[model samples]
Target: MFAVPALSGADDGSWMEVRSADSRECIMAEQRDERLGRRRLHLRLRFLAGESTGSYVTRLAARNNLPVEGVLRSMGIGPMLPVEPQYTEMYLSRYARERLANLAGYTVAEMQKRLVGLRDEFLMSDGDKDDWEWPWDARAGYIVQACSLCAAQRGTRSPAWLILPDPWHVCLRHHRWTDNSRSTQHPYIDLSNLKDVVRAQQRLNRLGKHLGPAARWVFADACSILVRSGYLEDPARTEEWAALAKQLGEQRVRPLAQLSRLSLLTQDLAWLEVRRLYGELGQADYREWLERATRRHGFTFARPLKEWHSQHQPLSRGIPELFSDQSPPSNVVRRATGHELPSCLAAVEELSCLPWVRLPNTMDRLFL
Candidate 1:
């Protein structure tokens, strides 16, 4: 039988619940280390989905009324110092992961599913001790709070934090706006009154699913256009977001609140670019289409159309080069030369250098 360590705290019994019904067998068969006298904690906390390993440790410490450092030490994490899960990440060594999984009454596979930092790519195999570390470059991603309502439903007393990826700041279920900043003061903004923002998140989800890898390029290009046009900072362009901020009692609009508008604008711009490239629209025709598309999406370009063309001249000039050496495959040629264009841009690597273009074989039907 596995030995279970007695926990010292006011009894709540919530942590005793198994994370999943299927994990019951795995929990029951947990083993003890006779030599080290290592055992599972009597209270086993549920891991929040997409939770950072550091955040899980924090919640575990809070639930058992133990110091965060103490919990890390118990999991064989050492040289223990203060751990700020919201602002930093913790990478677990292979051995340390085993010990932590044993302590928490979970199998390694079970922990991997819920802990974002516990993935194989993030794990530290050379070291024995788990340590707080970040492996990515300066601005890859950041940790943010998980949905509060979702946490409460999971029976957590303290807030749970998540290592959210780009284009995933909004919690569709709770209508909360989560951000990638280090500040803990306002981790999530309530978007109960902002139905447009909620709809925008849904649209973003669809765009991601529909376009696959190409969605990233579309989103980045859209953001660049908006920033260049001063839509984010210009008062005239930010009226909707400003009103949303005021309703939420914030001094200024949060950039994330404009995601809904951004999503629409992204779709418009992506569709226009595809049409300009594949339809072989003339310069004047392309300019007219660009004007109509931007106006339809409520974006007023700060610069003249000629200036914009000069900046993105490569997109207009590179078509002949793309097909010069070898003609595009029959299907692609048919789609491009036909009167009715395909709903989305074809997945081709040659166009990758251009803004809002997709990579090879990653295309799907876009709604627009």
Candidate 2:
């Protein structure tokens, strides 16, 4: 068994209930050590006379670098502590196991929820399963953030039919997919069957509200592919709908309208302004055009992103290249892996050559 400091709040010496020291501080110090290229630390801490017993215990834990797992192990505990079932589980048990216990029945969504929740409980909590030490990965946070944005705007108004978190949203967010196998198991959503279709359609309906006139085709194409791939197998009449879908493609419907509006021509000040207006749309290229055009106008932009480039820069040296009144650049794509703009003008362009416009040095410096 691991050894832990026998610090306790209870008179009975039930020390395990005590929380560890400033977990944040300890983690920061560990980071600092790594930054300074140091490996091991020999830390010593002293308890103040005025410090509360709880604070003292926590300080001891931090000084020893003992984690929750370490403390639990020292107490001879197998950390797989079960928690009180949440409302969903209780309801599931009541309907699926108790009331309908005689019958073999379980909803797909309900089963999916239970599987994910249990897996998350294991990863997020100690063996006692009461406390959670959520691990953070820049990548996982990004995925979660994306999931949240998608979830938030889910039914509001978006062309994308469904942004279902693949297989396991929770596991992805926590970044412990290896320990949580449920994420990989339910990879593709089952949209072919009746019940699953209803669920899928419901999700699409929420997403459909956000669809711009131009984005309709992309949505249609995605649906067509799903059906053709047997993921959306429909037993009803099929050819009747196929012709209608073909006609839609011929008309350049759905995604065409939105696509047309996303012109690549950089010279169009109107387009550039539109891109920069929302601060959200038009992706990186929009920002690029905005910066170049704004700088060319002889006004240095500082409030948003600090920039020094002017019309003197190579990209801006010539007549501004107005975005062609056509489709968005074929290369301009939404993120596939992470949230970072992988290879946009913002990433590749140099800013060192650009001069920083400074105010005249004056009375402010004279005092020194």
Best candidate, lDDT: 1
Each candidate's clash count: 0, 29
Q: Model 2, residue 303: what's the lDDT?
A: 25
Model 2: per-residue lDDT, tens digit, 49-160? 1111122222333455654333222222222222111101111211111111111133334333423322222233233322222222111111111122232232211111
In candidate 1, position 22 carries an lDDT of 28
Name the regions of candidate 1 deviating beyond 4 angstroms.
1-39, 125-139, 166-168, 180-187, 235-252, 269-292, 298-368
* Tens-place lDDT digits, model 1, residues 11-76: 344223223332322111122223331677767787677777878877776676666655654554
| lDDT (CA) per prediction | 0.54, 0.25
lDDT of 2 at 232: 26
Per-prediction TM-score to the true structure, in the order listed: 0.61, 0.17
